[model samples]
Target: MTWNFMCLILSLFLSQFVHSLNNNTTDSLDTCLQDFAFRTLIRHRPHTGNLYNAMLPANLSGMSVSIVRLRSRRLWNRGANFCNFHIPSRTIPVPHVKRLALVYHDFGNWSSHYYTVPGYSMITPVIGFKVFDASNMMSRSVKKLSLNTMGKPIVIRFSNSTLSDGMVSKARCAIFSSNGTLHLGEITLANVCFSQDQGHFSIVVPLKRKRGQWKLWAIGIVLGIGGFILIGYVVIASVKVLKAKKIQVMEKQADEDLVLDTIWVGRSKMPSATVTRTQPTLEDGGLP
Candidate 1:
């Protein structure tokens, strides 16, 4: 009796295990079908990719984004392309990002369909071309170069302009304790653009700011102005002093001339003048 019961129980256990495996397999298949259906619906929509791509820039952090293709059957034109990347703020400040995005809206004409999608537009690229042939496009090379390059923030720039010329590209971030609370400061970003381009493309290359250069320039300007002002003041003061000395000398000469004229007049009024006049009157009477 004990052997029969154990055998029956063992058979029931095996049956249950097989049934469970079947159910699990069915569930997985259902999930896969659902995914396929959803992706198909997205594919059939008109300009749906464009709308999604437009919204990408708002959601981006430290990565390069581009639109590669639109709706089409070709592998290249079927889906949106995204490049996943994360950069440490301290490693690259103000990244000079040059990553390009492309969109092949239709595969019917492969060459004609190669459209360089705008920054605001959404695109889908061939699954294989998501990174756009990294090997040929130097993707790995750029990535390695960026990783090896040192990045920083707090850059100062100097220019011929009276004001500083340094640009504050992206910043590296750090957390500091303030009043026992964590305070987040500037996080240097590798998304900076240095090109004279009018668009707001993120840059990936790091550049250092010119520091302490402003002080030197300011000091130079101040000294130059001060020297010019001092020289002008001295010249004015000297001119005033020389004019006063000349006026004093002229006054002294005038006083000396007046004294000499008075002395000559006094001699002419002396007693000898009165005797000469009396002698002249006597001679006139005798001759008469």
Candidate 2:
């Protein structure tokens, strides 16, 4: 039990340490990805309505990035749909520009490490997009833009989810807004999410039985088993003590009743003979 308590404390301490370290490290992840996206854009002559795949460095092998150049009028009229995101027809850039580039990315396996929904488990990859002004393609400093959905909501669809597997009833949409705030909402469609603005999006299932809180579950189990072992040891020690006391009491009684042989004659006591008789002593005037 004592050991288990120590282990639980240690786990909590390490959890905090790792969490703090993660926050520090992930703060630069977006900035680094943005630089790479811009490089990809300038490397190629991005044409309107054409989506081009961007390459990632070897260190980030499992991730993906894509960009689509579009005219603001076309976006307001027909909207833009690519890489699982659907911008509605009425949507327009908040600070309107003549042309814009929408950059899409998927964090692949690094999804959970960069973004997390505290009590839920992420089932699919983290995917999102950023809107950027592309008035001058050769320019270095392009301003980030936001969407005005114009009363219509943007939608994100996941191809990896199955609504028939009972996930539809349990899953909720998690939106990580541009300002790094979490917004959760119910999905009207089984495998879809709606949003007025952009950041990151994923579907998460509730941790009803602690499916996502593996650390807590592990600690509880360890403590429970350790307590059981401690109780067993106490019971065994108590039984051993009771038996030892009983044996001691029986030996004491036996010792008290134990007696050596003795002979009594005419109220005069004499030492008892053992295995041989003592020679009779006779009174004599002299040695005879």
What tens-digit string does per-residue lDDT give for candidate 1 at 165-265? 14223332111111122222332323221211111111111335679999999999999999999999999999999999999999998877653222235
What does candidate 2 score on TM? 0.67
Top-scoring candidate (lDDT) = 2
User: Which portions of model 2 miss their true places by more than 4 Å?
Assistant: 1-27, 162-165, 208-288
Pairing residues by index, what is the TM-score of model 1?
0.26
The alpha-carbon lDDT assigned to residue 47 of candidate 2 equals 66
TM-score of each: 0.26, 0.67
Computed on alpha carbons, the lDDT of every model, listed in order, comes to 0.30, 0.78
Q: Which digits, one per residue and each the tens of the lDDT, describe model 2 over residues 205-275?
A: 88767366888888999999999999999999999999999999999998678665788988998666477
Model 1: how far is 122 from its true place, Å? 22
Best by TM-score: 2
